[model samples]
Target: MDRNLGMDFVRATEAAALSSGRWVGKGDRHAVDQAACEAMRRTLGDIDMKGVVVIGEGERDEAPMLYIGEELGTGNGYAVQIAVDPVEGTNLVATGQPGAISVVAAAIEGEGKLLRAPDIYMDKLVVGPAAKGAVDITLPPRMNLKVIAKSLGKEVQDLTVGMLDRPRHEQLIREIRQAGARIRLVSDGDLSLALEALDPQGEIDVLMGIGGAPEGVLSAAAALCMGGEIQARLVFRNEQERERAKQLLGTEDVDRVLTMEDLAWGNVVFAATGITGGNLLGGVRYTGWGAITHSVVMRSRSGTIRWLETHHHFHHDPRY
Candidate 1:
């Protein structure tokens, strides 16, 4: 892991904190994402790497921020590619919900591949390496639950599934309820759900849902570094989305079995800064003195995971 390279991602997360939830999202999600995107783009420029947006917000016509394939940095030395989720949970921040974070990951030259994903739907299922091949989205939800339950030496009712709280998942919710398995519904943020799947000893046993295609790929990257498994199938219900996907993916088989290596490819670093409250990590805390922040930084090179909780105390004067 490049120690200095990690700082670029650190700056990106810090800039994401300056968004709508902090200043942009409450009433201006677009502006908030834009600000965060610009902040991320500029911060990346400060580094000594030539980078491009492999996974990011939306398309150029659909939205602003960091669109897919959008090149970043100042075209300098040391070619590097990035997959970033500037604001992983924009709606959560805008509506004052939970599980909002600023996340970014990168890899060295020739070790990364651009994730050309259009704004389409993708069915995702993920779990740690231990639970690999235990959960299959193609099968019925109940059958999948039972498979995971047996693998973990737990009852079906004891398994917890994390999913996006969207109307499209009504059938999945019903199935989970009927199957008697526990369900953890989240408003926004697929990366966290993916990470939950990567943590076997954690709360979530499986992550299954329909969300952004780029996010699915990014989650696959994290899962790859953590020795996890994920399966994704792109869903294009309209002509525009299909055309956009073809243009991006250059293939018709979006329903491909993609491993973790396929997602991130080579060595990477994953780091995130919380923006709101949640179960996995606490939200940013503030007080009369200054503010405090919590972060989880991981480097695939050394398999080191660091949980940093910092407090900053400020005085009226520049120096005491």
Candidate 2:
């Protein structure tokens, strides 16, 4: 994969963030998501690559654009597989909360291994490099917390776990509390929280519980670049979802654990731009003549992370 392509990926995220940032706190999640999806699709077409959407917003019937199997980019460069979330936290953006982001991950086709995650719920466990070999998705929540705490050379009480605040997580949350570990319950955007655990300066020590399987793949790309770890398994709530999973994965074994390599492997690029600030990156700041965007771009091949702060002059460029 070309190193310069990483910057182009950032540009796509920045465009999506700039377009969706305006709708923050507007209480219209659909509008915000649509704005981001449109911006991302348009910007991605300008990049010089033959891209296939391995994991995306949804199937062609569910989403208007950026759907799975959709071809992106101009037909002029390297062939790649893409995973994207134009708006990671639509509710957060709608309610004027934090942790909304525009994310993209890419791997060179035929060279890298990319998972086509089914559009279903997935139970996930994530830890940073320090605790990579300690946590396991198959273990009980309390046991995994203990292992991670020990790996970090801290007591269970000193570790903090981040999880989505949903009804399905009640049992998981109780187990974490029983283990004497602190918890941060977020309204949405588990992807950002998962990435936050990779940063030593961040407060989140681990991310647990269920989230979108597509987001799990996106998080795996970032984890691969940061030397973090992710373990996930698909969950089917009913027969309809189970049938859908069988069709997508071409198998009946939904109990299998998906590791980082199973999600995203080989040389990969991950990029994200913040729409609302929280732990990982700052939100977009608007000025009189232009707006500033903050983003992170990383490559798994080199284990290199780049923080980009770009100033977009809307007046100078009609594209904005």
Candidate 3:
């Protein structure tokens, strides 16, 4: 893929964020998600790539646009695989909460190993560069936390693990607390938390427990760029989901642990724009005539991370 494609990915995310940011605090999640998805599709249409939506909103019947297997971009550039979450935390944006983001990840057509992640739950463990080889998903939460703490030159009691605050994670949360690690329970958007753990200066020490498999792959792309680590295993909730996984992946053995390279390999690019305020990036700020968007774009080949604060003149920008 062309190096310039990284910035083009950022533009798509920025358009999604800017479009959905308008619906913040509207208490309508479906509307906000639809707005973001539409904006992302529109922006992606202008880019120069023959892209396939490997991971996206859902299957063709579930979503109106940006669905799995959907083709995007101008078809004049290199062929690539795209993974996108137009509004990662729709509930957050709807309730006027924070940590909502528009994220996209891409890999050159035949060069990268893009995981065709099924729309199901996945167990994930993410850590920063310092603890890259120290933590393991197969280990218990307490044991993993101990190893991570040792790597970071801290005690287990000082480590903080971020995860979703859901009923399914009740036992996982208990185990972490028993292991003497502090917990940051978020209502949604574990991908942002995973990325935060990959930042050395960030507050999160690790991200664990179950999340969307597609989000896991997207997070893995960013983690690979940062020299971080993510270990994931698909968790088939039932027989139907398992059968769907087999049909999608062409296998019944769903117990394989996917490393960062397995999720997103080769020269990968990741881009994310904040729609609401959070730890990694600030939310969109609306001025009288324009809005400012905060986004981060990273590439694995060059290990380049760019933080952009763009000023969008709403009157001049027809996309918004």
TM-score of each: 0.88, 0.96, 0.96
Report the lDDT tens digits of candidate 2 across residue range 1-320.
77778888888899889988999999987788888888989988888899989998766324344888889999889999999999899888888898999999999987786788888888888899999888878888889888888888999999999989999999988888988999999989999989998877779999999998998999899999899999999888899888888887788786789898888899899999999987778888899988998999999998899988888998775233
Best by TM-score: 3
Candidates 2 and 3 compared by TM-score, better number: 3
Writing each residue's lDDT as its tens digit, candidate 3 over 1-320 gives 55678888998999999889999999987789888899999989888889989998666325344888889988887898999999999899999999999999999877775789888999999999999988879988988988899899999999989999999999998898888899999999999999899999889999999999999999899898899999999998799888998898888677888888778889899999999999889999999988999999998889988889889987786343
Top lDDT: which candidate number? 3
lDDT: worst 10-residue window of model 1: 311-320
Query: In model 1, how large is the Cα lDDT of residue 187?
Result: 74
Kindly list the per-residue Cα lDDT of model 1 for residues 90-197, writing each as its tens digit: 777767777887788777776555355666688888877677877776889899888888888889999899998899999999998999999998878877888877
TM-score of 3: 0.96
Please give the TM-score that candidate 2 achieves against the real structure: 0.96
Question: Against the hidden true structure, what lDDT does model 2 obtain?
Answer: 0.87
Q: All candidates: CA RMSD in angstroms? A: 3.3, 1.7, 1.5
